[model samples]
Target chain A: MIAADGGLGIVATQRAVLTENGPLVLASGAQLPHVEVAYETYGALSPSRDNAVFVCHALTGDAHAAGWHEGARRPGWWDNLIGPGRAVDTDRYFVIAANLLGGCSGTTGPLSIDPATGRPYGADFPALDMADFVSAHRGLLDHLGVDRLHAAVGGSLGGMQVLEWALQEPDRIDRAVLVAASSRLTTENIAFSAVARAAILEDPDFRDGRYFEHGVTPRHGLKVARMMAHITYVSELSLAEKFGHRRDTAGHDKRLAADFEVEHYLQHQGESFLDRFDALSYLHLTRPMDYFDPFGAHQGVVPSTRFELISFDTDWRFPTAHSVRIRDQLAARGAAVEHAELTSPWGHDSFLLEPDGYHDRVRAFLS
Target chain B: MIAADGGLGIVATQRAVLTENGPLVLASGAQLPHVEVAYETYGALSPSRDNAVFVCHALTGDAHAAGWHEGARRPGWWDNLIGPGRAVDTDRYFVIAANLLGGCSGTTGPLSIDPATGRPYGADFPALDMADFVSAHRGLLDHLGVDRLHAAVGGSLGGMQVLEWALQEPDRIDRAVLVAASSRLTTENIAFSAVARAAILEDPDFRDGRYFEHGVTPRHGLKVARMMAHITYVSELSLAEKFGHRRDTAGHDKRLAADFEVEHYLQHQGESFLDRFDALSYLHLTRPMDYFDPFGAHQGVVPSTRFELISFDTDWRFPTAHSVRIRDQLAARGAAVEHAELTSPWGHDSFLLEPDGYHDRVRAFLS
Candidate 1:
């Protein structure tokens, strides 16, 4: 595990997955080479390296999974869910949380330099996929001398990777947990993602995705997309309960003034996210999530793959029905599988929120 | 009733009860003087004038309620629910479906010329409320020499105005039918409306709301707003059943190529709406709906107002819960009220779809 330092926290700089003929060509007609994956490790790696668990992050998630960074008051992204005695149980297993390949956090992504142009990939960053992301995670595992993982757990986009890893390297993954994950991108999902991408692309400061050097960013566009995305992450009942006609939201820092507490919460979530995330990275990640199709490559190849799938009832983004498709397919293949839809008002983001009884199910399933 | 012409059928123009001081000042601060409401009359008017029924339209809805429009093949927005012997039967009762006061469909709205400035009010048009809308409807009724209405039925924003009319002029309207309507804007609802407004305001072509003269309307903003609104109009289950992950929607004339079927539907709906609606009027009508609060205005005032509310099970926008609130409020006020949530997958637009058995309830309630 990397040691915590300064405000930036522990930066893992050891993993270098670069190859001689590297910077592979991407679907967007761009090349990425000299890739580096900065990731964090939790718990101790067993002698067989079979106790390792990989935690895939969502669209806005980072590599940080638990513990506090130096000078930072907050813990990791899944701090509550992946703590000493939490669901992921870092104390009981070695956990790896790596920044995705097309991320702006610590890994090599859009902000990383292109060797050929000697500049950041920016808009030129090659369009990516679940394969590229999982490959990068594999690269990190190779560097760490870990050949296989005991389990892969993820939610939303992270859940996509879990499914990808389970299919891509079936023998390498022992157990897979997919939460509110879809097997393929539906038309509505793709449309929403397209709108989000268009929002950033239309921003004047976007600079055709070169906004970083231009001293301007498509903050407004990013914020709008984030706001839109936030709506899909929650349920109407929760929104009604939280915000319901309370329109006092005036000036900044006023929480209760929300016309609907849900709107205020979403607006705040969107605006705050824009500040920390790179628009291009956001575009890269969301598109892949939309294009994801676990059935495409695998086809009828592995009908009987072991799987455990869970979804929240109120999650409309990737509803419970989506999870059922996976379970059904796996069952058709005669694979060992179980599926459950937890009663939750947290919607698509339920996996992150530590609502009562949710973690209990996670622990029970993983146990 | 003014006869339907040029693709608009069975239209009626009424100078219903006009206030001497009206064209009242709108939210845009422009006064709409000598207001004229273009409506369509269906069924027969009882000798007592107590059988007159008024049906209001949504933001982009037109006055033509039932039957075919001249020069056009399609029927009115609510044609599915209204016809010669439909729910609100034209043969048995005099039905009035009018273009709202602030609408662009042959009514006095932002698109109308401000005689004072010799230009369309555009964005300069003052916002409106259910009060202003009902007043305009009242004016049209007065001109028809109707002292009372048997019932007022409307859905969405139109339903909102129905609620307002029942409360504001309780004596004028004895029965009210609100479908998928809310008494007050939820924060989430207002926030979504705010996002739509911001989109319109952000467009450079909007030109401070004076795009009509410059021939540069904020089509993109309007389209985006409409797209956003469309998401709320349909149910998730309906979307899954209709579009799902199907990629079969591809053709030159079909919208499938744009993205997901849902997105294509939204884009088409939004784009088509911009052609017939005024951007400013969208704002004007939406704001009033957002601020429509029966209890806020007349707390403990009209609790005894008898009302009938109906909602569809799939109408997520104005879900059955919203109707229940109206019923609960009316009941709390000791007003005779009944409400039902029809099992339909049409979402908030079901009021126009006329699901099976819906007309029977309406007939029983009115009779």
Candidate 2:
């Protein structure tokens, strides 16, 4: 493993491969002969391994949750929430962040080679759900020989996994934090995802997710999809504040080029996203999020784990109502639950921004 | 002209071409040698030619405002609110609906042949504004020999034109109805439009707006654009009610297909739009809407015309706050203004959907 610092001191991403044991069964009834999970850890595990905390990431996120990778300009996605004295305080908690099963990082995903065919899985990768992701996390836990976790934390789709952890293995998790995430995807949420997936599929270069073999990426389609999703990720107030009516002088020709500051911002966002994300993984990962329904039939068997649910006031994607619902459901089943709806113009992205208030609340709860 | 009945009696779309009458200058300082406006009319003109009610259509609308075309499945966009006894009644007024200058119907637009090259204008279509649309309407009025209008009414982009008409020719428009619109596009509004336009531009087939010559339409790009715009046109509540978690059994294989009802609806909307609309024309019309700011420098010169501004409470696109701003501005200048923010779940499209309350207000105000 290589270590680097992004102001968070030394941290490194490590890999763990599980093979030669037995085929891992997936939620879709498919099996993978072997799997590799890319994970990063901060601080040291306690002698009993009870102080370890696991952090799951949202779509497009990777195992690099904190600190900088070697030669990388930017730190991990959740660097703001982790570190010496940050919300998830690596000073005290042994934090473990791993790329999801269908992510495009070093994790096993559509880009992974199929041992049977000696080729990349591509569209041949089996469908996965939140349960499958939880199972994969279990594999990482087993590899580390961690019998119990002090806490599990996540936001957005990550939050879904946190809830799933509590539900699927109540005895292994002591605390779970879900931020800006719903118990299940809403119709509007599914609609947005559907459109995003369609955008990628319609790209000619996509070639039924076989673009990797053709040496071409569905850049335009993926960018368009990202642009659409980006709109849902931010609040109207944030967009208005950042790029309201600001015209781009160079685009005054009035053709199809971006004329408004918002257009330029969206274009930049779309283009930058293509550099880090995989189109097939985006399609695969988003499916589980749309199908998430952890508390649907298991309402009567709610876990008694401590729960802290946070939501942003301006988050229309997963509104505060979703958090409130989860809190209420857990409370109804005699679970200790704390819910907070913070005010922020960043909307759903507030989970990754406005760290002061969020960190304070998180720190106080965790402690 | 060919007549057809949509339960409100006979109506037909008529075309008027203006050539050899000098160039029509545009707000962008560009000029067209000739232009064509497609229009439809109902009822008879008063003896004094003073009972003319000119109705402007929104972004996707054309001349067919209140009637059925021969062999068409649906009536004009505003059929519910414009009939013999409905709002803006044709019983006592001559109602006129004209396709904007840069529209797809029978009007001159990007799809029209450039007189200079005998080729379609495509991306070369000059930028237009609400002022240009109003001017084109004026040409139609002049051709019809209508000296003045009893009222000029519109909604959304159409509402922008109504406001512009009142500001540009106050004496010619006695009453103005503006629905679900604002004096200028908000920053968030521009952001949505920017994304929509970028989707079309990113399509490989778009070919820098030269797709018409390549024998291929930017179907994917246009569909993606339409899908994004369709989301803004309706409300979250509406989407939830109509397609909440309504999964498609056929799409269970889950390889970038329509898995939810909303996705299917959006796909249909995008596909149908391609048949009736031109992508370049969409780009042309949306720009003027974003640039419209009639009250920017003329705050003190508010038209003294009687104004009826209607908005929907659920419309996030152009919420009631926008209408309130316009009303306050007009009222501050002592203009006669009636404002109503009706409740609806249809969002911005409420103007065309729920007709009872809207029609009552329009009928009473027009009378």
Candidate 3:
């Protein structure tokens, strides 16, 4: 536990291995020994300790799930859903959120030091998958002395982890909630991912993903990739409504010169991401999303699991149809499952936003 | 006159001034003395000359609109629609296809040397508009000794030119056919354009638009831009049908390794573009597209004009609704207009690809 500041305690955790196991071989053939995870906890564990809730974040999110950092204007990314009396209700349940295994945010990732050489893993970091990420989380829970979770909730890649945890450790989770998740990467998804990866690889400054030491990062390349990804994150209708070539009259000159406000927004997003994230981490995490299959090696049906799933109607990236596919699989096996296609214009990001009737549905379902 | 093999003769006009009297100034505050247009003519110009037909091409198209080329597998870009018994019916009407003034395909664009400096214009090239482009075409007609045209026909950006001709130069064109066209750039259109421009602008090798003499070209930027543009050119349904997550079993290993076939396709388009086209010309031509407003200053109403418009039901980029908007605008002004939203899965590119129904409609209109 870290020190408290103001009326709120600023909880932080340093990186540490969850298990003393042999090096796990990665999909890319690299081996990782003693994986470490950085996590934070809030509220108190229930009497049964099964009231522990796990929160997973989307792309670019970290373990910091709530509270203010001195002068921070915003609390945490999921501050709306995880605070006391909020949707997840930390008032009654212990909450845990961790940075993924291959993340740059205080987790054992490409930026972490290699014990064998005392150097940053950089590109040498092994490729990861949803199971590998959850395995690290499992280790973290072991360290916390919590054997089971009341619920696991996530969206986007975070949703993939929730699905994985349900399939890999069925008895450990009482509920699994997935939002805007994909069962497997479609060819178009793979195709777009390839474009993003190529954008980085083609950057001469990328230096074979060793730009960290070169005092130069492929910011432009990363920016391009992020811009591409950002487009997929929102729906066309949302884009039309939010950005709609409505020129920002005050800064209209610069806006028109650059094409439009949306372009400028995307450019800023792409450029800013490079400063905070490692390209290697991006490479490692996205690959797993590309290969994820909850049904495992089975070609016909989803893996048997009792689950609760939700998807947005406008999310073209991971549409409602994908969730329905999983629902059908669970139905085929007669496993308990409840799913819904929420109407929202926010696209894949809708799960995180406050919709008119979304909170009530989540509350009723979780209850 | 140039020799066209097989007893066919083609009259080609080289760099003729289209607008010599008070040439319009570009958006960049640069003034051009005269706009130079390059054009080629096939078949005979009728005695009345009313049989003269102007064929407009889409982005990346050229004056080479028909017949075979040496060592080529396919004919000209529009060979299927402009030949002897085809849509435009070259045997009955003299067809005039010109390379736009701000294009790289043999027209006077940024690739052309500025007489003032004896160097490529690069970023110094004047910013143009649809009006400027139409003015240049008018100059071409005057140079060819033609007073008016039976019809001005085009699709996409070319379709924009056709609409401009009908509205701005009403007396010079008896009829106009715009296929898959928008009167002005939508917010979404400008947004996509911004992504493409950013890809080119952010490339270090772009050298602020002076890449030609730097011994390097921003091929990656150009390719990324093209890849982004390609997504807009095809329909989601078409993408789902043609390239849907189906594994190229033989190429699966390669795809799973670094790049997929789709990646290769995008890279090829990006790199090959630099070999044949001028980057500065791309910037120059597309800039005009942003400013194109057939209606008076983007009032969301099409200008009063005599036109028969055609669009594809599946063309989401410029869908049937876009054509209907034009029709509605024309109706408001009591102008004669006809529109048919053809059914095709080819999306925005249907006008260029689906020649069966497309040619039939054109033939009936022309007759």
Which one is best on lDDT? Answer: 2
Model 3 CAPRI rating: acceptable
lDDT tens per residue, model 1, B159-196? 88888888777877878888888886665576677666
Model 2's alpha-carbon lDDT is 0.85
Q: Candidate 1 at B318: error in angstroms?
A: 1.6
lDDT of 2 by residue, B104-211 (tens): 999988989999999999888888877889889998999899988999999999999999889888888999999998897887788778777887877889888889
By the lDDT metric, which is better: model 1 or model 2? 2
lDDT of 2 by residue, A242-301 (tens): 877777553223444687888888989999999999999999899887877778746677
Task: Please give the C-alpha DockQ score of model 3.
Answer: 0.41
Model 2 vs truth, CA RMSD: 2.4
RMSD in angstroms, all models?
Answer: 4.8, 2.4, 3.7
TM-score of 2: 0.96
Local distance difference test scores for all models: 0.73, 0.85, 0.74
The top-ranked prediction according to DockQ is: 2
